[model samples]
Target: MLTIIDKYILKKYLTTFGVMLGLFAPIGIVIDVSEKINKMIENKIPVVDILIYYYHFTIYFTNLLFPIFLFLSVIWFTSKLANDTEIIAILSSGISFTRFLRPFIIGASIVSIIILLMGFFIVPKSSEGFNNFRYTYLRGDGKQAMRGESTDVFRQISNDEFIYVNSFDVASKTAYNFTYEKFTKDKLAYKISASRIQWNPKTKRYTLYDYVKRTVGGLDDKIEKLDKKEAKFNFDLEDLTPVVYIAETLSLVKLNRFIEKEKKRGSSNVNVYLVVLYKKYSIPVSAFILTIIAVSVSSMKRRGGMGLSLAIGIAVAFSFVFFDKIFGTLAEKSSFPPLLAVWFPNIIFGILAIILLRNAKE
Candidate 1:
């Protein structure tokens, strides 16, 4: 069912895209290494760890800049075709412009599939490794940053139970001025207070210092006190204090579950997680939109030649990234809708692609 021209253009499309990634990935690695080498040396990082970090870094880099690389590749190859009059020759052979675009759409579909799979599965794992390595060795106070806010932590662990801690220490897995309360039908049921609480990972239990429990009843209150007590809670340590980048480290399924759990907990940063979730889909859809835009922009010979096309392509790509970041930040900081913020760039550029394609066809 495939024509000779379709195969030829598809091969060119895929090969050029691959070559673009091949060329830029090493440059990205080199730049990253140059920036982080001193920190690695200071930390006395192992060679194996550094190698592993770069492996993850490659995936992270490719996924982050996929659109730019894809756009440039399409423009580069299509401009070459235009300069050589190859596209003009093909079109003169009684092929309609819309028919000529079949291969490009197919290529875009292929790239979109790859992007979707990577965003859903591969990039999450690589992001975890890349971000963990950076925070563990590259940044000052990274541990505290990863642990998120350590003071005045409060969370609803369940519909009826809530917990609070004045301060937490990441290194010791300890909380100070810990309080736990339970409510039944909006009425006070019981309360537990501890001067300090330390998690014993080996035992999967908590050791509470100066532990006290008070029970509420009809016209009566009973209180119990203890010097120290070992207990188990329904929540994990991560549930108590999650990392700032925890959402980025989870795969699609886990991220969905995490969002649901956070929604139940009434987390204020739910918008941030929603933005991440929506972006995983929006970015892949941009592959199609950007590919179309690139082809439309560069499919004709110009007085300025490939340079003009490339300049336009780069400007458009940067504008797309700029719009994505602006909306993402707005959603994260304000109450903007995450779904709208993620898709707005794609929607704007999609319309631009349509206009450009129509002009190119004419």
Candidate 2:
């Protein structure tokens, strides 16, 4: 059902994209290794682990910069076609420009689907490993990467229940100075305090040390004490000591459930997670928008040839990344809506795509 021209253009689009990615990915890996090699040596990290870390980082970096590579590749190859007068020949062959764009749209659709799958499935796993290694070994400051992984935790578990811990060790799944309180109608109902609390993976329960409980009555409170107690609580250790990269490691379904749970917990850090969620969808859709814009901008031949097109494409790509970072930072630091921040660059670039396409058509 497809014509020869359609097949040819489609092949060119995908082939150029593939070549661009293949060429640049190694450069990225080399630079990353060069930067981290000293740290790996200092830490005496194994050669196999270093190689594995770079493997995860390669996927992470490629997916992170997919839109830029996609835009530049489209512009690069299309500009070449224009300089060779191939576009003019195709147009003169009784083919409308709109029909000529069919292959491009098809190519964008294919790439977008792959990007979407990478975001939802592959990237999360790669990011977890990549970030974990980078934070643990390559960087001396693990707290910045993992956030509250080894800090005190305090949260309102429910309207009537509150919990606190003086300090927690994620590696050991243990907490010190643990406290839980229940209240009714602005009055304390019961309170429990313990010197230590530890998660027992084998039993799937918490063991508390030097446990104490207080039950309040009208004018008196009954106090109970124990050396140790095994119990279960309504929250998980992950909920207590949240890592900054926690959201980056979840699939779409798990991400949605985590977001809903965080909302119920009244967490102030929900916007950070929301930004992650919205960007996963936004980044893939922007690939289609950027492809349209890239094709439009480079389809016409200029005296400057491919250089001019590549310069313009790279400039536009950098601006897209800049705007995304600014808005994303605003969402994380200020009261800006995460959904709006994530999609604003896409909305603006999509409009640019339309205007450029119209001008190219004219």
Best by TM-score: 2
Compared with the true structure, what per-residue lDDT tens digits does model 1 show for residues 6-30?
9999999999999999999999999
Decoy 2 TM-score against native: 0.84
Candidate 2 yields a Cα-based lDDT of: 0.85
Please, what is the TM-score per model?
0.82, 0.84
The global C-alpha lDDT for each of the candidates, from Candidate 1 onward, is 0.87, 0.85
The local lDDT score (0 to 100) that residue 302 gets in candidate 1 is 99
Which segments of model 2 are wrong by more than 4 Å? 141-154, 160-203, 206-231, 241-243
- The total number of steric clashes, by the backbone 3 Å criterion, in model 2 comes to 0
For candidate 1, the 10 contiguous residues with the lowest summed lDDT are: 141-150
